[model samples]
Target: MKIPNNLRLIVNMRFYLTLCSALFLVNCSSKTDHIEMVYGQTGTSLFQLKNKQLAYTVKKEGQMVLDTSLLGVTIDGKNLGSNSKISFLNQDKVTLKYALNGIKKMADYKGNIHSYEITEADGFKWKLEFQLSNDGVAYRYKVPGSGSRTVLGEATTFKLPESTRVWYFERDSDWKLKSHAGEWLSADISEMPTVSKMGPVQGLTLTCELPMGGYALLAEAALYNYSGMRLKAIGNNSFKANFTEGDQGFVVDGTITTPWRCILLADDLNALANNTMVASLNPAPNSELFADTSWIKPGKSVWHWWSGKYVDFREEQDMVDDALALDFEYNMVDDGWEAWEDKWKKIAELCSYAQDKGVGIFVWKHSKEINFPENDYTIMGHFLDSVKQAGAVGVKVDFMNGQDKYIIDFDEALLRKAAERKLMVNFHGCQQSSGEYRTYPNEVTREGIRGLEVNHMQEGPLTASHNAALPFTRYVTGHGDYTPLGFTEPGETSWAHQLGTLIAFYSPFNCIAENTQFLLNNEAIAPALNFIKSVPTVWDETYVLPQSKIGELAAIARKKDDDWYLGILSSGSSKEMTIDLNFLKDGEYSAEILADDIEAQPINLEGLNKEANLRQWNTAIPFKKLTEMVSVEGKVTIQLAANGGAAIRFIRSKVEVK
Candidate 1:
């Protein structure tokens, strides 16, 4: 092969050219194969998926119901979906099987995950992930990038079928300070009514009953370092993305994966209550950070704020002693805890006192104290460290008052920083939970509901109707700091109704809004108090009984370890119902029940009128009895008075009673 040098060079060049041509052809073929392949999943073809230019179409019942809803992101002035060429990169389908921890501990989350990876012409990559469960479907977009990226807006749309009836709350500009107020209304999507311009804009979650059998819920999940999402009506049964804007809009560093824009489909209301997709869509806890979550306990805490008293050391110790006697985990020193001279020192002393009694202390601070200018990163970090050094277990940051991108970022920053210092957080006067606790388990609870504290200022009292609706609506999103188990007299609902809230409404850092004197001195509900003390805030499993109605009644059963707790709430009028205990293992069990005393003076019928003075409504009553029964057949019946409720604790019997 030792030919002339020129001839040999020419031969080598030709050989290289031929190899390059073959490699190019193979690459072209690979790209062509990826583009041509139809990536999708089918559950009996009732749900069909297809994508082009990031525009996805979902076919339901053989009809293209959700048509050409484009999913994209806007950065600066450039739109990714509009300006770039899109190509399919890959597709995969798998079953996601996992267990929950924290608020929903011991719950099983199983679903089928379908992931579609695509690339844009400008080199931006996106992974559109969809989870198809028996209950509904949810999808989120993930993008991997470097450096800081300015996110102008998100382009996620939902085009519903015409003639759908929707239920939703209007958003509040002052979302941080007040509970999400206003009533839930049923309206046709095509002719949606306008919300009050003085208050914040529309809320995030929207429920629409499709003309076709099932119902659909539009909500978001895993909101972190991004603006909370709200849907704006774009006419023609179409809604577009309306993000909560921050000071500099929404920006992300390194990577920006938007929260899951979820559409929960349900055949019945009960299915909506049972769906855990919101929590499942979020990433699990960092086991490395919370390896031994034993210290992360969820139980009742005595909050001094509801009493409207500036808690001095003496009052603080009384509450701490009360929590200790009640076997409660924490005693919260709210608002005025820092007003005392040498406040930090006094707090440390109280912490020591409480710690010895096996009770933890939660200190309170304004949200402004942890945000920029007022308290920068260095100051916030030092403050948390100081609190941790003081032996306080958690911090109740309150009065956030906004749902803009800035406030969202601030809320997330507080969680992350508190976690770094090994402290728990309970956000008051803040937006609803977007499954942020799944990422940072240190977030104990958040107050975004119209709770017991509102009794002081609300024109009309919070009703059982509102309470009944919460379990399916607000509570479905995440933990509601409703501040349940109040023993104050002249309460809005019957004593039994308040007791049931301990189980119906979930909050890890559950706050008992009444003073210690009420629980100890009230001879009428002492047995009921004992039941409240024994109830666990976090549950392993939850079941919504078939009798649940959005604005009328809510009956729920939650399990922790071997015991089951049941809570039933009724509105408008007295009622009777039976609960099936079949969810329990096949074994005899002892049930301790506390129900309304029907013999007590009936709630003033005139006061029940919405126009009557709220003070006239009777909220306190004597309990009928603390009855115990052996249940082997797995069924029990109880009666509830008007605006009343019941709570029961079921424990497996050690001896099988014949």
Candidate 2:
């Protein structure tokens, strides 16, 4: 039920007074003010807000187990609940309501907001706010001040039950290069703090399976102006916040509000797959700046970087022509575009050509140049203006490399400035998304994943298992610029599996990372290419199929308008599965199936020595067919090859007027 603002304030005041009285009555006891707020529609989750710490738990069959176990942040070399005298000042409760624009899955979000004000022994005031919803719970800390304060570190801890199993990756300094492609290890929570080859840090997202048959995902939201937080297991099933290295921890000025620490709760893996709580914790988009987002289109782009080609003006023009031929939206002019003497003029000409063909252009720029310290604001403005004059639609800024306060601020400033110039932005070599795209609609996509681009590096190739794991991990946080749908160097996975990624991965500015000529010549997968060309980058709704497994298979169904797209991927081995279409609407729908051909000869990757030539492989294995009958109760069975997959598009049939 919605309450009026005035009535909400009055009720909050009364609740505060009642809590104060209760604290006074129990002042002599060790247990401080024992305040509890029940969340979730079915009373499945409970939050206990104490004077100094917050604890969360999930209930199963009338019995609740500690899902979060314990959570609180230490500040300025002092832990909140340890050796510190803390007193509650006041508390307030309200409802947070908002709608999403130009994104995925759900249209709106509503949650309960609970906030508390407290003072520590040293007179430092802390405001802790918690947002509780049916799907998840999140909390953040705010320290209001006039000048900068030195933060020694944080005590954000996640303690789970003894029998919990964790799925996580070890972190390293070269995280940008290794992104989400790290091999996930399953182990007991007590065996954590698993040291990586580089050091002793854990990845951003940690998925834990509770003893009570539920799951919880530990991650952060709205990460800005602070060093990124990672988990470090301190033994005894406890993980604490370990900030990115800095000389004096994290320095914060003005009113410092830390990022939202989130624990997403789910009954099953499918619920975890469809969770949108991370996006709910972020701020809404600034509509005043980008009121009309009609021109900000999200579609496939042709990239030359992945093909190992030095794209001169002629090569760039060829890519533009290929984009037009393939019905793609943009042609990317990568790294070396700025080296020519008349680079700007040449780029302007190419952009004009692409514009004439109804295709957009995206230009790449070094992050250091754009984030340059000397007169950066003016320099960036002038550069963006020049790009706008050249008729380019977006910019790909690369290699910022750190998540410190300086880099974080620069990222936000860059997005704001890019929005001002009416240009979409794609960030490369950046940190994982914290829903910044929701606030800046023009911020199309960010490469926080170990995408196919890393194929050229010395690191191990991204496997089908890694591809299967992304949708539940990195992609769940926000849009991942995985640069999907690559044909070159198909690495263990079949060509059909590569096609499936075009539908599986979610990127606003999706990159078709293959040579244009090769993609056009592959007649066997022509229909799949057409589907990829027409599929919407953003979706209205999504469903995770029951067949989904962490490193084995990932099958997803997404809806855009009246049409639905289903993508299925398999890892390590071949398997046959029947997919039920009951999630469809009542209307009859025609389906197009694209699957791996059993008759096709497999390319021997061992012979090619990991440096496979694209021209030599018999890459055409996907077989496409359209079904004659239409029914909402239809079931399609598919037999996938090892490291292969399938993509299907369903269109609802319409009745003709008599």
Give lDDT per model, in order.
0.70, 0.73
The residue-by-residue lDDT of candidate 1 on 91-122, one tens digit each, is 44544455454334554555666555555556
Candidate 2 lDDT at 427 equals: 90
User: Model 2: clashing residue pairs?
Assistant: 74-155
TM-score versus the correct structure, for each prediction = 0.84, 0.88
Best by TM-score: 2
- Judged by lDDT against the true structure, how good is candidate 2? 0.73
Q: In model 1, where do residues sit more than 4 Å from their true spots?
A: 1-54, 59-68, 83-86, 93-104, 112-127, 143-147, 170-185, 191-200, 246-248, 373-376, 489-492, 602-614, 618-622, 626-634, 656-658
lDDT minimum window of 10 residues, candidate 1: 39-48
lDDT, residue 596, candidate 1: 86
